[model samples]
Target: METSFKIAFISGKLGDVDGVSLEVDKWIEVLTGAGHEVFTIAGLYTNPLQSISSDKQFSLEYLRFDSTLQHHYEKMMFPYLTKHPTHLTSGTRDIIVEEMMVHGKELSEDIFQIIQDNNIDVIIAQNTNAMPMTLLGGIAVYNLLSEYKVATIFHHHDFWWERSRFSQNRIEGLLNKIMPPSDIGSEHVVISSYSAHILSSIKRVIPTVIPNCENFGKAAVLDNYNSHFRSDLGFDKTDILFVQPTRIVPRKRIEDSVRLVGMYGRKYPEIKEKIKFIISLYQGDELDDSYIEVIKNLAKSEDVDLHLISDRVSSVRILNNNGERLYTSRDVLVNADLAIYMPKWEGFGNAFLEAVSCRVPVVVSTYLVYKTDIKSAGFDNLEVRDNYDDEGLLKIPESILIDMHQILNDSEKRIQMTDKNFEIGKREFGFKMLSEKLNTLLDSYSDEIRASRRRLQKSKKSYAV
Candidate 1:
């Protein structure tokens, strides 16, 4: 008989445009399809889990990204890295930790109650276990894992060490201890080999690698509803749309995209006049906004028609106050001619795969993980060596420009390249790949799963009294 268990996906935030939130949905779908009852618990959920889950869902405001605990965490951690190391007094700093503990302990109790109430057999801390962005939520996870006997999986998408801003923080010790505990009861799942190596070297814990994936079965569409998206974004039907479909943050190296379009246009002025560089995502919770002005100025100097259309995109499709349709990134994607995915750093580029899924060619940068894991996937798309000089400028090769021009001018080249990349993407990075990895990982935990089932059985019997 096949094993089916009750699983809970816990995160600080879900049902949002963030990478962690987006990937969590994929995991839920795969697990649900595997005949397991799945649920979601987050601090915020604009769209609840019941929409996709077979089990009950829970959302606590404090577990969300903008929770009080997160604010306290920012207050406690940011000062050390900033010019204001003395921003908060010792007393004030102590008070912030106190608030985190107060809220964290409360969250722990709530989670414990939920587990007891529902008899959940497995817990999947989706990014919440590995990130200290939600200090209280991290603590709550650690506390629960330490005390409870439930089998847990830590889907660590990105670690604090990977980001520069998190380097010199006040809560390093606490972050190290609980952000991802050294517990033998839980298994760690990281997206990249680099992350798995870090976990091994630092925590002495091995991890399972499950690269982010897409549902290639659900084909992208260019329906009449989104037919006017080009016009809405001030682009003519004849214009070539070179889309930068990522959040407008520093690490995205969106400036490189501006440069790519600028140089491409400079080389081919006839098409430059017809090319529009569209950024189809929002400026996420970036610590600095100075990068925005820098990019805007750069785009102006290059004469690239850079359009920021984050306002028109959302996690769910809804109408604005003007009663206009709020289209998703998919809507923006199928209408695109090309995608620019030149992130200086990425946990993994969902948009890259989305572009591949939409049969759109993407100019993907060779970020470390892409080189370590994804580069050898035999994708037929533009490749830029992730090289930077002493001046911190991306050294994009001239060959990449020639290739882009060729693909843009020739429809056959675009179709053939996108088709080959889509086939490769579907073979290696699709849902079938994820489901197989997940099944094997879960099967390895057969002993613990059986043990967990017995524990729940005992608990249920006692509660009946």
Candidate 2:
């Protein structure tokens, strides 16, 4: 067997229910299984996400790039972003850049110290390079790449230009410069083909497209632990548990799910009575205020049993302070009759893949990534065309309601669809596929790391002299 490599993953915030954190966890698992030592640099890391041995605990503090982490300070500091790109004084803009540069240097120093302490061979930046949620952090990534001799994988989840939440104002210059600036030594990885095309067109840098994947090897079964979810959540055997396994954000088009349930109830009032819509993930909307409230009111108007169960769901399944067993997002998936992922936009379809893995029939809106990267994977689902006007309102499809009702009522159809989708999900997006891609990426690197270390030693000796 080959010797294991040391890989460090750097990110702004982790150990949460966000997609970037989830994907990074998958990468850590795969790399560790392949006998590589995995480590993290982030704003936060939960115990479940960290499996490193006690011996590898050196430089843990250095691993944290604290100031670079995302927080409420961001919207205030860069008010020009997400807003209408209002004009500020030249002094204010300059001060912002100056602060970023100073902080970027400090963060870069910590990264270098971590490399020196841990002898880290490769750096896998998790969603920090492209997105400017924290411009200082993004700039810090550039400084590290330029100043260090380490191998880097800029794993871009999404870019600033792709998101309306980013600024097109004064910081545009800074964003264009270091929000994943072109670096020759470092490798780039995009989650979808759409991003790959755009990166190439805009940045003139082509990258490997490794779609977000799941551990399809693990079968979701009715174990003693997870079997309690349906009853514990107060659902009788008769109630159809329809789950939306995504954050309650505006772009997710969660209103579509509520409206679908409403429309279903109007057609077959009896079936509607048994339908329960549970959003398994947390509510997340920094830009648009009170979308959750709107969703709740809409569900009320439509007379759908919509429950926001994010408080009940967590990244890990553990006992709560009240001695009750806390459930994860997976727990909800296993107990669900159907999953609906109707996002207007997505970096990639993670929740959709999860539904497929859990062997539940799913209904997905044709988000861009799903349309381009995943639709051809041959998974059977209640897929619908992206239905909505400019605003986030749902233009309800009457035809989908009929098919969805038919599918829900039939057990044989559920089995057939779920089995086929699971097989496809396992074949294309499994850990085996991810491992192969990672191995290929690792092979592309030279044995120059050893030589780079020797050069660093010489430079240090001269500096001391």
Best prediction by TM-score? 1
lDDT of 2 by residue, 1-465 (tens): 244677888876666777887898888888899888887776555434655664543332222434433333354345644444345578976776686578678877777677766667777887777876555567667887787666778999988776665653456777787777776777889999999999998888889988999998886666898888878778898888899999988778888888887887899886778989999888642445578888989999989998877777778778777877778777789899889888888999889888888888888888888989998988777878876677757666788887888888788988899999989999999999999998877776535444445555664566553
Q: How many backbone clashes does candidate 2 have?
A: 0
Q: Summing lDDT over every window of 10 consecutive residues in candidate 1, give the lowest-scoring window.
A: 46-55
Give every collision pair in model 2. none
1-465 per-residue lDDT for model 1 (tens digits)? 658888888888787777887788888888989998887778877555444743477877767767765765775676644455556677877787777788888988888678778878888898887766777778788877776566778899988877777767777777888878888878899998888998999999999999989888885778887887887767799989999888888999999999999999998887778988999888765556788899999999999898888888877777888887787787889899889999888887788888899899889899888888888888877989899989887898889999988887799888899889888999999999999999998888767866766776776677665
**TM-score, per-candidate, Cα-based:** 0.94, 0.92
Our model 2 lands, by Cα RMSD against the true structure, at 2.8
